[model samples]
Every structure is written in C-alpha cells, then in structure tokens.
Target: MAAPEQTPAQYVPIGGDREISDRIEAYLAKRDGVDKLLKISRYASKIIIASSLFESQPLNSKLKSFESSVGVTRKALRLGKFLQSFNALKKSSELKSKRDFMASIASGGEGLYYFVEQFVWLSKAGLIDGKHSSRFSKIGAWCEFVGYVGSISVKWMDLSEIGEEKERLRSESDENVRELKMMELEEKEMMKRLSIVQDWADWLMAFADVRDGKGPLTSPLLLSSAGLLSALISAHKIWVSCKA
Candidate 1:
C-alpha cells in the first residue's frame, strides 16, 4: 500500500467544471496516480478471473495474462520505491533517536521489502532466472507483512494521542478555538482510520502471498478483494493529496 502523507489534512479544491481530459491530465500529473489506477485494474482482473463468470479456460487464461501484464507494469513503476521507505526510516530514526522500535520496524521493514522487490520484478520481467521468483516473492511478502504490522501499531498510537489531545481541547472556553481544533483532530482521525484499513487490506494480501495461496482463507476471491480494497484506499489518498 502507498503510504499516506504524514501532513495534517486541509481543505482543497477538486473536480471543477474542467474538461474530462483536463481532469485526467491533472490526476496523472501526480507520480502515483497511474500506478494506483493500474493497481485497481490488476486486482479487478483477479476478481474477474476468480469469479464463476470466467469459467472458460481461454477467457480465464486471457484475464490472467492481462493481470500479469498490469502487475508487471506496476512493479516497473515502483523501480525506486525503496527510497521512500528509506527516507522515512532515516527521518523517523532521527526524530526518535533510536528508541522507537515500532518506527524502525515500520520503515526499516518496508525499506527491505521494497529493496528485495526489485529482484522479484526482474524475475517477472525475464531479466533474471524465473526459478528465484518464488523465493524472492515469499521473502518480500513476509517483509511487507512485518512492515504493515508496525505501521498499524504506529497509527493506532497516533490515534490514541489524537484522542487525548481532543479530550484536552474539549474543555476550552473559546467556542471558535474548540471548534477549529476539533475539526482538525477529526480530520486527522479520519485519515488515520483510512490508513489503518488500507494497511489491514494489504496485510491480508501479503499473508496470502506468504502462505503461497495454500489455505481457503487465501483463496483468489479473498486475495483479490483485499487487493482491490487496498488499491481503492490508496487511490483515494493520492487523489486527495493531488487536490491539496
């Protein structure tokens, strides 16, 4: 899942009466916009492939091929994505002075995940031996799962802090001040909740990967649904950030 911006939410303009082409251009101007759309399409294809509607072998084969193509393209787009996690790790480490274990787990694990993912992408792209793909994928999935665990823990802690701050602000005598602060906290809370949900969704997919699609819980339908959910949530965050 794409990380939501750490900045506080603020009002922003969006979707004016501009031409559809212009709106699309504005959206694609953001680096992650195309990737998010591809993610949605990739997972949507999986859902179709898993569904009973595509029972024919030929149709299913085509759908799977399309999904594979989209998945590979998405990976290509994330060629340097590890830098994001690395930068976050550096900043978080500086701020926490090495005492925040969860922070390290979140950013460090994600960095490792993305770093390892490059080889997996290469395997998929036929630049490396296909035999290493499974091992690389499993390692990446486990790292992603660990990263999400830390990420969710950190977000929950932030929500707890926000809740406490809101409690303190509730007693403020100034009506305007209270309302403004409350609104800000509410927005923050909403974003945090959305992020948590997205992480959980992504975590499910990671778990499926780690399991190598073994159990009923990791069925194609479940995995595809989780991926689609995470993709949509990511798209939502990116669109809102673009508007901002």
Candidate 2:
C-alpha cells in the first residue's frame, strides 16, 4: 500500500549549529522533496490565478506563467521517472510466483504515464512539436487515473488485512503484547488511510486532466485544492523519511 520508495531510512541526527538549514538540505537531497515543493507551488499558483484577488490582467498573466514554468520544471525532473515504476514492477515480480494483479496494474499504469509524460514535457518545453501535446497529455492523465485506481484498491486490500490481523490480536491474552501489537496495527491503519487519501487527491487532478478541465468537479478551485493537499501529504511522508 505504501509507495515503493517509502522504505524506512535509518535515523541520523543533524549535529550542526545550523540544524534547521541542515535539515532542509537533507530533505532536499531526496528527489521527492523537490518534486513535492514544486507541486505545492504549482497548485498554489493555480488557486491564486483563479481567485478574485488576482483581478489585474497582467498579474493574472504572470501567475499563469509561473504555474506553467513550475509545471514544466516538475516534468523535467521526472524525465526518467518511469524507470522507478519499472523497477517496482520487477521487484514485485521477484517476490512471488504469482503476480499481484493490482500491483501489476498500478506499476504498469504508472510506468506508462511517466513514459508518455516525457513527450508532454518535451512539447511544453519547446523541444518537440506541440501539436501532439494534447493527445499525449490526455493519455498520460488516463494512465495516471488507472494507476491511482489500482493503488487505492491495493491499499484497501492491505487495510482489510490489517483489520483482520487486529481482530485476531483481540484474543491474545498477554496484555502487554496485545496492546503493543494493536498499537502497531493502528499506526499501519493510519498510514494506509493517509496513502488512500493522497491517491484520491491525485486521482481528482487526473480526472480534471482527462476532462480537459471541463466539469464542475474539475473547476480550478477544486483541482488546485486537491493538488495542494496531495503535495502536502507527499511532502510530509518524505520529510518523515528524512528524519527516520
């Protein structure tokens, strides 16, 4: 249910006088950190651009430009990100004789999304013809939507299993052991719930993309809010890992 790259990192304390700066540096050392920050900026810009506060035409233009610039930069950073999904798929396959259906779907869809995204970026960056951008963008959005659906399903299954395990733990007569195990399961349940929420947030944005920003649910305010929420969740997870 967790992200493939969310494996726990060893805890290492920052010992310098500039502890805050050191922590910031440490966080930015991870790729996800930068991506999440940019995502926040991008979505924030979207919200501001659509807000009544930015009624000035020139200001709105600048806001739109900033959002577009941040978006393109994020895409640039993800140039080879599809390989991460491929690696996830490979790792999953190696772990079991029978393939996990939802996992495979998630990984495959994610890989395809990122692969198509490269062209989208290239077009946006002016390195390629922009004519195909719309088509590629639509395809990428659908792929992302598919991936999120698979991810949500996988997480739901994990949450169910965790619930079952917790139910079994109820019969454990050892007070201390039962409490500790229950606590662990509670933490895991909380994490899975967070992951599902994040996935749904992203799925909303993907829905907007596929709809070409047409529907009422795909309104700028809604999509921007969803994108910002998803970015914050991602950032929180990455920051936690940095401190682990």
Candidate 3:
C-alpha cells in the first residue's frame, strides 16, 4: 500500500509593510497542520480556554498570572490574527480553510481558540493528568508558550475601529405635525444605528459566555453590577440620539 500523498499547505498572504505581517506569513509558510496553524496566533500561551476562570489560581511569585480576556487590550494580536485569518480563509480556494480541516472536531461555541488549543496541547501531558507533575507542567507550558511567541503576535487597533456607532434619536418630541413626521421618516435610520450598538453589546455578552466567572459587563470592560442580559438592555437604553 502506498502512503497518502502530501497535500501542500497554501501560502497565507498578509498585507502591510509592518514586521508583524511578515512574521505571521513566515509562521504560516512553515506550518502544515491545524495544531501549528492555531498556535501561531495566540497572544499568550497560558490563556484560559478549557477551565472556569473563576476557579482562580493563587497569586504566584513563581508562575505567571492569567492573560486578559478578549477586548481587554488592543494588543492581543494573536487572537486578532487568528480571527482575521478565518476571514481570509473564506476568500481563498487554494488554502484549506480551517473550517475544512477542523470540520471533524466541533467548536462547541468555543470559537477559534478551541481549534488552536487542540493543536497546541501535548498528548504526553495527558499521561501526567491529575498528578502533581501535570500541574507543574501546565503552569510551565503557559509561561513558555507566551515567551516563545513574543511580539510577533501583538498588534493594536483603535477603539473607534472596533464597531463604533454614533447615536441618532428618539429624543425628539412627537409634538405637532412636522416633528412627528420627521421622526417617523427617520425611525429606520435610528433603528439601524441602534442595531450596530446592540451588535457590540451582543459580542460582549458572548465573550462573557465563553469564559467563566464574571459577566461581560463586569469583566474586561469593568462595567459594574449589570449582568449579560441587563447589559444588552442598557446598551440600547443608554443610546438616545443627540440632535444635530
């Protein structure tokens, strides 16, 4: 019997004169499998994926602290790159989209991180599972993964670029014929902006959903008290239109 033929990995093209783009392309060019594909974009190795984040580890002078959740920083380029690549994969034919390769495994709504983690995790580590050795190694691996990836995965985005929607209206009084007529005419426009604002809110909730412990409102954004559903409501309630 003959061995299965090697399918060549497609070149991942990233544009920009920046060094990070060059670095990402270089990582993609050498890698062949899903495991290699995913790790290339992680901002830090010790990022919490499998376990409940609320189950916190003691503050360690020895081991590194946990990484921030998404939206915690604009510099989380590894995650940004992984998501960006997922978008790019949609447009190309020659490159095997990660979805194609990972179709057998499921997301379980874990998104891109789950796929990357399956690739980066070690099978041998399973041998030590539930043992003291495993705990030590897990901590060490987190440190090493973050240290190894370095600045290649870091990129910054302006907050405005991250789905900003300017507020429009409902603040206008329904008084008289003309004001009411204008509000009626502009209701759809107001709804559209409201929808955009809601999308950001929905995303925040999803981020909260995937991680354990605090709700999105209380977590990265440090919004207090409000839980996910309430945050969703408040996102809509707070955005009354300013008259131009």
Candidate 4:
C-alpha cells in the first residue's frame, strides 16, 4: 500500500491542566522502547491516545479486534476531545510496521543472527509490510541492514553470490511491476513504478559504507564483504575517483 502524501499525523498538543493526556505523555515519554508502545497501543484507543507523543498507528492488529473496536475511556475522549480511533482501517498499517521496524533496527549492533531473526519475526508477526516486506525479499536489504547494525555481516559471502541474488531480485521486482501495472493502467502511477528501483539503490549505497574499523570520525572504507572476495570491487572503483 502507498503512504499518504500528507505530513505525518500527531496527537494534538497537551494543553495546561489536562491530566489524562499529561499522564499518558509522561508514561510514554519514559517508554523509548517501541515494544512497550506496541503493547500499550495494541488497542486503537490506546494507540490513538498514547501515540499523540509521536506519529504512528496501532500494532500487531491480530493481537485482538480490540484494535478496531477500541473502547475509548471517557477520560481519554475528554482529554483530547478530537481524537479519532482510526480502527478497522489498514490505511495506517504500513506506517505502523515501518515505525516499529526502524525503531527496532536503530540499536546499531543487533548482529546478523539477531537481525535475520528480527526480520523473520517482524514479518511473520505481520508487524511490517510494503518496503519492509519487499526488503526481506532482497539480499541487499540484509546486506544494508548490517551497515546499520554492526559487523555481523562477516566478510565471507562472495560478491558473485550477492550479485547473482541481486539479479534474481531485479527480475522479481520487474515481474511485480508488470503484475501491478495492469491494475493501474489508467493512473499516472509514478511512485508505484519507481519505488522498487529506488529501494534497491538505497540499500546498495547504504550497504557499501563499510566503516573498515575506523572510528566514528574517520571516513569509511568499504569493507570487503567476503574474505579476499571483495564486495568492494565495485565500491572501490567509485571510491578511488569520486571527489565527494
């Protein structure tokens, strides 16, 4: 599903002397962990109220239909006075999942084993879709994920292996476009057509930034993904010539 072009939605600002909103904000402000937020907002009403501190929707929808038929406490309604439950709607699902996924990955060192497990768990749990799901279908996504985490992506897998996988992913993405295009033949569909390519490009650039054991202050040297196999062959070509 496509994201709304509108700016991210947020809960209305808490006014002075408002207690429920203030309590929820104080409670949620301490919850830097999305897992906790997911649990708290598992229901649409809580999701609507607790999420005012940030821009997001509810979580793990199948956790219960309580998600849609959220019983708003009169207390909550009185506090916000303009909140929408947005229940039973899939419109916010994509946003919900991505927000959860990014927050999960922000740890910066979850390692490969945990990373794969995290991807599988998040996807199987239906916590993510759209780019998140499509990325799971790409080798580049895993490769890029290691960049965000630590050096869990050891230098052992060959470029040839990754290249072959990439070729297969490109073909799959093209097939997806062909399948989707028939359903949108009348629309301009600019984003629908370009999103896959853009996603792959973003993944590749992100994955190539191997810090090469340098400190945070150092320029990154693309770490070879495989011992003596060199994922850096292509990256090095551009690195040696670029003035950036």
lDDT of 3 by residue, 8-41 (tens): 9997655444555554455444322222223222
Candidate 1: segments with Cα more than 4 A from true spot: 1-15, 19-24, 94-99
Model 2 C-alpha lDDT per residue in residues 96-202, reported as the tens digit of each score: 52237788778989999999999999998888999999999999999999998888988898998999999999999999999999998998898789889999999
Q: Cα lDDT for residue 218, model 3?
A: 35
Per-residue CA lDDT of model 1 for 1-244, tens digit only, reads: 9997698888664546455556577679866889999999999989998876767999889888999999888888888899998888877775553336788789988998988889999998899999999999999999999999998888889899899999999899999999999999999899889999999999888888888889767988888998999889888887766542
lDDT of each residue in 10-60, candidate 4, tens digit only: 877566447655555554443222222332343333333333533444443
Pick by lDDT: 1 or 4, better one? 1
Better of 1 and 2 by lDDT: 2
Clashing pairs in 1: none
Candidate 2 or 3, higher TM-score? Answer: 2
Per-candidate count of clashing residue pairs (backbone under 3 Å): 0, 1, 3, 1
Would you estimate the TM-scores of all the predictions?
A: 0.87, 0.86, 0.20, 0.17
TM-score ranking, best first: 1, 2, 3, 4
Best by TM-score: 1
Worst 10 residues of 4 by lDDT: 220-229
Q: What is the Cα-based TM-score of model 2?
A: 0.86
Q: Which stretches of candidate 2 lie over 4 Å from their true place?
A: 1-22, 93-99
